[model samples]
Target: DTAVSQTPKYLVTQMGNDKSIKCEQNLGHDTMYWYKQDSKKFLKIMFSYNNKELIINETVPNRFSPKSPDKAHLNLHINSLELGDSAVYFCASSQGGQGGDTQYFGPGTRLTVL
Candidate 1:
């Protein structure tokens, strides 16, 4: 079974459109995160939630928002998707603070905005 999974592994859409990406983790981790990877393969943390509560919010654009409905599910919503938003989105989760914080990444959602 996959520890983490993100729906619509690839998303291609035009600018000014709204889109959403869904994610879930079966590992029962307390902390989950959203990460953006650019062409250079640099991964930046976008948001992180612990136990269904927001904990870390990177200084991302207002157009990007993340929601965690439960401990196991976190979804991302983007409004007016811009070309700069064309990057791979990765969903990850960790147990945190117990020597179990090693992040496990999903297959990734590739979003392309034209």
Candidate 2:
């Protein structure tokens, strides 16, 4: 009975390889987001989707992509993974833009590139 869940909590790979992380939520939220936490512990929003349409897109590389199958699930896919991509990826969701609504985050998927 998890509110949010991310697959392969730990990911280890080499540079130039492709990988993906899956996320799901049972909170019945309409907005989902992807965030990356760097080694310095800087949390930055990468993408946000509402009803399967992209609502927010930060200055992320083209190698990164996000897909929302439904309002309850959002998956992230990365191509040509680079060392710079080694970071903790988080999946979060909110109940829409409800006046500074707080988002719930998953445990996080730690990607380590060699």
lDDT for each of the candidates? 0.93, 0.94
Could you give candidate 2's per-residue lDDT for residues 1-114 as a string of tens digits?
999899989999999999999999999989999999999999999999988889989999989999998989999999999999999999999989457988999999999999
Candidate 1: misplaced stretches above 4 Å?
A: 97-100
In candidate 1 the C-alpha lDDT for residue 11 amounts to 99
lDDT at residue 87 of model 2 (Cα atoms): 96
Candidate 2 lDDT: 0.94
Instruction: Write the residue-wise lDDT of candidate 1 on 1-114 in tens digits.
Output: 989999989999999999999999999888899999998999999999999888888999989989999999999999999999999999999987247469989999999999
Worst 10 contiguous positions by lDDT, candidate 2 = 93-102
Q: How far in Å is the alpha carbon of 35 misplaced in model 2?
A: 0.5
lDDT of 2 at 69: 89
* Cα-lDDT of candidate 1: 0.93
TM-score of each: 0.95, 0.97
